[model samples]
Target: MVNECAPKPHVALLASPGMGHITPLYELAVRLVTQHNFQVTFLVITAGSTVAQDSYLTAYPIPDLHIVDLPPPDMSNELLNNMKTVARLCYIVEQSIRPLRSVLNGLKRPKVKALIIDMFCTGVFEACKDLSIPVYSFFTASAALLTFSLYLPTLDCKADGEYVDLPEPVKVPGCNPIQTQDLMYLVPKSMINEYQQWFMHVSRLPMVTGIFVNSWEDLESVSLKAVKHEPFFANIPTPRVYPIGPLTKQAEPVLTKYEKETIAWLDKQPKDSVLFVALGSGGTLTSEQLTELAWGLELSQQRFVLVVRKPSDCAISGFFSAGSDVDDPIAYLPDGFVERSKGVGLVVSGWAPQVGVLSHPSTGAFLSHCGWNSTVESVKYGVPIIAWPLFAEQGINAALLSNEVGVAMRMPMVGEGGEAVVVRRKKIESVVKAVMEGEEGKKLRRRAKELQASGRETLSRGGSSYETLARVAESWNIET
Candidate 1:
């Protein structure tokens, strides 16, 4: 193994205050501080920041890991309801960058080498530019997704309305022709016109020295190659793009007492017999969708564990309920679904021990929303997946897992005008059954094992990801 600890470097990771963003950043922080002897300060804000605090509290502690909190914005409305509100929050954060910059400047540590910021937190890059602090953009999504985002300028020209003929499968510079479906979540057609301008502006930012993606080379070789050959990215001489994943593998399981019990239950089950189902922390299911999912799980006749936040109006009584706030749409899961499947299933409310459950020997398959983190974690464990992609890049991740990776089966997506659509129960059951028992399922399982083996090999001594991390660390130049 490379000696990441030999030359200790001080680093800071700035995350967009969300679970999806913070979790990977936390894992990276852990790896840098523990494995590479780098001192890291994790910058966070009030909203959605508690998740990171809780996670770090439960995990290994590093004396150098500092949490710098920015004051909350004075707003009553949810940012999800309005993009403008999100932009305003970003503006406020941008204003707060000076204090952060001052703190970084004051860090007495001589080896403070680099600043890693979330892709969305462009303010950090702008703030630290004059200091010569090499700002690396950490993309939490797939390499294919990044490539697709880069090509949005081209896709925009060809687009007519809601759909566009997928640009020909020409070889992209750093990637292969990622299937159109895999790129579907790149930018929603509704937001493309506006986002295209944003992408264009951000792509030219000077502080973005390198792009660090949380993916492995073997998994995204075509896309990685495309990124290398792209013209727009050619001039950023200091910021090289690197793929260092699957990051989930580096995370140690830090389950709570409740999570430990869940793992114990999973252990009692037959090897590869249990299916784990979870939507990410932020995803919400409509009442109708919830019922269908419940019915579908029942029909699959598989031993399963479903994690939900709340029960819907149609939900049957006597099931475990997390009692989330009524107004929170996610709190509306169907009741009694857990009781009906009692002996055959377990329904965990609130947060789940996702990594621990997935790594369990009894876990045969994952019924996931196809979030990139979940996708990589499932692949890491060699768990066959029933892909039920929801919003964002989830659908794209599902497509790659099912069609490209050959290790997962995709559930049919229903709905026409985006928001009005939902995946039905019948289709969910069908896909689950196919993934759990059919010949295709067997093939996917075999492929999953092969991928899992490859992941292990890549993380071993002299592996591509390992070498990439070492190279990036050595090449880093601290502006202090």
Candidate 2:
């Protein structure tokens, strides 16, 4: 009898044209090639292509790895402008599918067996359908977002002007009832309609085999179950939805050069005394907001490190000032605020290694914008949070942390000129002080510690996420 088990299949990944999307896909690609021996080819285009190529070459230079370039599209500029144009970019993305198909048809090797695609790149599945390549959709957002995306049509039906008032709680397949407010509303109304159409068309593609999320099962078990039970998704063979994250596992243990400096500063501070504040790379704060935050941190009299990014609005002076030029953010901060609270604060502007800062022993609490990646990282390190969600699904995640999980507190915001604005300086000061030294803060901190332990146990040898990853690798006949 001849042995029938086949060699690992060649896999191609089509990532969204941004660092946020490309980085995680690259990490997964590295794991696929390094540990599983899959022949991997990554498709790249435009400026982000250069970054993808550089990262891949530095991380994995094996002969089996390949990079294919696609023609740059005009809409690439718009894609980078804002989240609002995402739906318009889809038309441009659809055009690339044919070119990608031609490239894949010409590949000569272990043979292209599977396609791992970013959730936004639904065009790939339509183009590759006849080739019988199994395409898996990877969602970087939480399962709740996916659930919301799937039910948008229903929400559209119930919309009133400017807001959709959902009754009690809307139940989504495979997940618990979610409040209407939890859904991400960053996309414009017109774009939401277009995206809904796009999703409907793409979900019917025959080649789509599964959905993979960058989350851990333990963290999102309820949402995962809800996703599995959807009727529309029933006919489409639901590919194994695995929560393989916090993707930071593969990042080298050695801290980045900048991180080393931040850590060194942290070392001199008392244990659990610093309040670490940062937003994701894309987050920006107005000068007014910046001044308020500075005063708040100073008022708390807590040792702190704040990574402040440039403001997005052009009207603001020093809007894009790299913090390197100034000794203190307080120079731009409100007058006399720094003098009043001299010893309690330190501000590091622009980029800082957020994970490194959060993991430091002196770091007792986090004031964050509540991006999912940051949320998971904070939980992993047992850092309690003061959730000040800026946009996207961040508000949803913040709600879960503050209300459902009891691991975080929400900083109140007020609606101004149709947009939700952060609370005033006095409110900011009170909240910061409460999170840093109050009994409520202590309870949240304890809960965060428990959540952190759960994450560790889940990522350990036999944890749910660990097993899910193992099964996913095995299903592809790739060695774990």
Candidate 3:
């Protein structure tokens, strides 16, 4: 195709089985191919019976971006349910090495320059090393989480015992203070036993030539400085860190048949008036919590679109498949909730057209689960958040967004024993009103807008994110 002129550098991007990981990688690939002129091949690990991959490809098909699927691990349903997700994913990736090696050996033209892998897929690091291919770790989390991962090695979790029971706020060198409850509430006990395995993975981080994060400098300058300058990290000989992010989805993402109806409904709402609610893929609430959320939105007197998930479904079971046209979510809702707020709210069960809703002219605020992707999207659109964290790194993000970033208001959650507690309807109404109308809401809005402008600026030509990718491109040249 190039007439033996300028050969395109081929780079492989490896994504594990989750929307949280794949979405950012998808954004990064788009920029790399269209903006930087690299040929990207995605080596995707097959997920269990989820529709995430199929939906993403169907919704946003970049034919220029080649894909090769690695075989799914033959995990037994019973064992798979009990095993920690990270452990299972990492183990599955290890099993796929034979096939991956065969594929790599069969390569002809456009040789792979580097393998950029999700942090969870650390098995590929060694394979790349043996094959003389450049390898990079991609952190899909916030800079704060990445910093924590680097610092985790230094802290003695074994001596301290369980994550939540730690006496004081766990402090990472040069980074923000993290409370035990906020930081470790969702960490599985299996992670403690697997610390040796985790260390084996992260210890390999510095061995790579570079580490790519889905974040930008302006967004987390303080945390970033800690990551780069902290004396604790100095002992490790860390990789060249690249904060080449804000790679969140653009507003108005490609539409699916499911989204068409949602978009049409949104079209009728007034400008800067509707509140969009959806917890990111892994978030779910108990039946009681749902009732409060419904009452809260109704009492706020705000126009809204809520993406409700089926309570019986597996957590982390979403990528592109949320709700299709076949399911009606109304059955599970609170009694008379829909009839009481007919025109005022549109409640749909399943996945929502998130970016489309975020980018709409009528969208005023986002009530999010505080997942990094949702956080980035809200930040990208200048929409203030009602930070409602349920699990994983969401608590860290909620702390960052509400306390550090000033772009959101944190919800007061009282969950315990893996059961969702009822957040009072009054608390919900207050937070909703605060973002939808009050002066405090206005302030949050202004800050979010400021972040939005900076986020976009960094992606523009000659901007920081743009230049950061330049370094990544240059790294590709070293091997080619």
Candidate 4:
């Protein structure tokens, strides 16, 4: 048992802007405070924060966790808005280093023992170094993505041209080759160089003391093995990797009207009968694609609960402004689409209680953007997936889930002449059917349940993830 008398070792955790980054890091802070003996100061970047992120922080005020919102960066909103997502985020972190240093200096009582930063906030390494504090990275994505990031620096030195125009698929050791078009986020040609530079800088794996990946061993054994024990990595200066994850939220209290209505709808449906469709906080479909998706779901004739956002020209349009807008997302659908699908489907605008919906008995399959958080949550609930990835490492995640993990059916990228073009309604309808009622769906569901059981075992006492986190916590104690 942990000593109740000693002053807790203080750890400062820095989280980036989006919900995807904020949620996992916040969960980690909760675990550090509640499970292990630690006092955490949770720091978050203020620029580009969304309503969802704000509401999440306001709702859960933990006892031992202190949330510190750093002042916004020096860059103007107009200039920041003009840059691409990766560029904007990198700029935000780069400019906040001085303020971050100030925040570190001001903390009194038990001084911070270690600082854990988000993957995007690696630029703070110098600030922490100046303050004589050790830094670790809280990587919120998969171990597979980490593997690719670790190997990318070598590719940067060796490759002659931009990755978008490569003649063949990009190959990472011990994993399947990926097409160039599916390279994380698709940057416009004008901004490609900026995106590439940001990735190259962050991909330097040896910069941190260690990495805490949000994945467990059973779900990503091959990639995790390649990262830790592969002989090819021996020559590289890699840090210790810990797969202490499948980290998820505690059961949230049902308080909002939207939450109540969503759960009530799920309760009315028959067991294992409904499909839950939600893109991540930032995943958006184009206007044409949104209409097609609506038609497709209507054609599939499956019971579905879809969380819709207003369509935009860019696939990641909701990244900065997901929940802030007041417009009805249903306005973007095909004419009378809501009326036609009223009895068969329910469409929610903006956000829904994802965990509650996923855990509902009526939820049979998830139509997801394959964000890491959504992917792990589906595994936790034993819900099979129709993987329709949109942006930012989601394609890699979709492939991992479908080809390697056996928990999802891959939705083929279909358009008239190019992969970047829209996916027609027929293809969407077909994949939806395959995951909802077909033979392949059964296999996916069975595998999903098995993985769910495995994940439960890992998070339980004396399990793999449980033991891994305990060991890390013990090391922190020794350091303090």
Q: Write down the RMSD of all candidates, one decimal each.
A: 5.1, 4.8, 2.9, 2.0
- lDDT per model vs. reference: 0.67, 0.66, 0.77, 0.83
Q: Candidate 4's residue-wise lDDT over 1-480, tens digit each?
A: 857787888889988788888888899898899888788999878778888788887787888799888877677888987887777877776776658888988875487888888788877777888888888888898888888888877777777666656778888887677767666354433477576655655575588888999898889988898878777665676788888888876566676666688888899999888999999888888888888889999999999998888887777788887566566866898889889887788888878889899988999999999999999999999999998888878888988899889999877773433356667889888888988889999999999999999999988889998888888888877884
Error of 4 at 308 (Å): 1.1
Best by TM-score: 4
Tens digit of lDDT per residue, candidate 3, span 297-400? 99899999988876543344443343332466676678898788778888876778788889888898999888998899889888999988866678888888
TM-score (all chains, Cα) for each model: 0.83, 0.81, 0.92, 0.95
Q: Candidate 4: misplaced stretches above 4 Å?
A: 1-3, 184-190, 414-418
Q: Which pairs of residues collide in model 3?
A: 322-350, 322-351, 323-350, 323-351
**Candidate 1 wrongly placed segments (more than 4 Å):** 1-7, 71-98, 157-207, 229-239, 249-258, 311-336, 414-420, 477-480
The ten-residue window of minimal lDDT in model 4 covers 181-190
lDDT of 3 at 230: 80
Better of 1 and 4 by lDDT: 4
User: Looking at candidate 1, what is the lDDT of residue 449?
Assistant: 94
Query: Residue 343 of model 3: what lDDT?
Result: 83
For model 2, how does the per-residue alpha-carbon lDDT over 1-480 read when each residue is reduced to its tens digit?
A: 534465556788887654446656766776677656676888764433332234433564556667776766555555544433344445545655657767888877666767888766877665687777778877776766666665655555666433324445666555666655554344535456555645564354334577767776556666776667666555444455667776542332333454566677888999888988887645667777878788777766788887765554421122122223223454566788646654566666565667677888899999988877678778889999998876667777786778767888888763533346756778888888888889998998988888788888876768776677667666765422
lDDT of 1 by residue, 329-383 (tens): 2345456665678778886765577888888898989988787878888899899
Write down the RMSD of candidate 4 (Cα, Å).
Answer: 2.0
